[model samples]
Target: MIYFVNILPQSNGDHVIHTENCAHLPNMRQRTILGYFKTSMEAIEVAKKNYAKCNGCRDCSEAIYNNYN
Candidate 1:
């Protein structure tokens, strides 16, 4: 499967990384592409370096957790 992720800049100087299809994703015009990854864990790792996990994106968080564990 082709997986993708994105990074959304926050007003607070933080960024949120979410799965491409995450329901919590901000509108397309509001987000930046972080690039695609082979696995969700890869995307999560990259996201963790620059942004916090979005609390509203349970699917993203759960995917990362499940992939890592």
Candidate 2:
């Protein structure tokens, strides 16, 4: 299953709302956010914005993997 893990923060909280089945992948279960956006373009934008502020390599990899895979 493909998961759209939102790495961007929302106005309501610091969490990234994710899409369904985002956690289905064994490696992605621990991911913070996975949300289904209206379009892939939007998802990519959010991912890029979030990746830029990542503090760890794992986070950067995870976000990239989630967006591409």
- Work out the TM-score per prediction: 0.48, 0.33
Q: Which residue ranges in model 1 land beyond 4 Å of their true spot? A: 1-16, 52-56, 65-69
lDDT of candidates 1 onward, in order: 0.54, 0.40
Candidate 1: clashing residue pairs, number: 0
Each prediction's total of clashing residue pairs, residues at least 3 apart in sequence or on different chains, is 0, 6
- The global Cα lDDT (0 to 1) of model 2 is 0.40
User: Across residues 26-53, which tens digit of lDDT does each residue of candidate 1 receive?
Assistant: 6777665657776666665665665554
Best-matching candidate per lDDT: 1
lDDT score of residue 18 within candidate 2? 40
What TM value does model 1 have?
A: 0.48
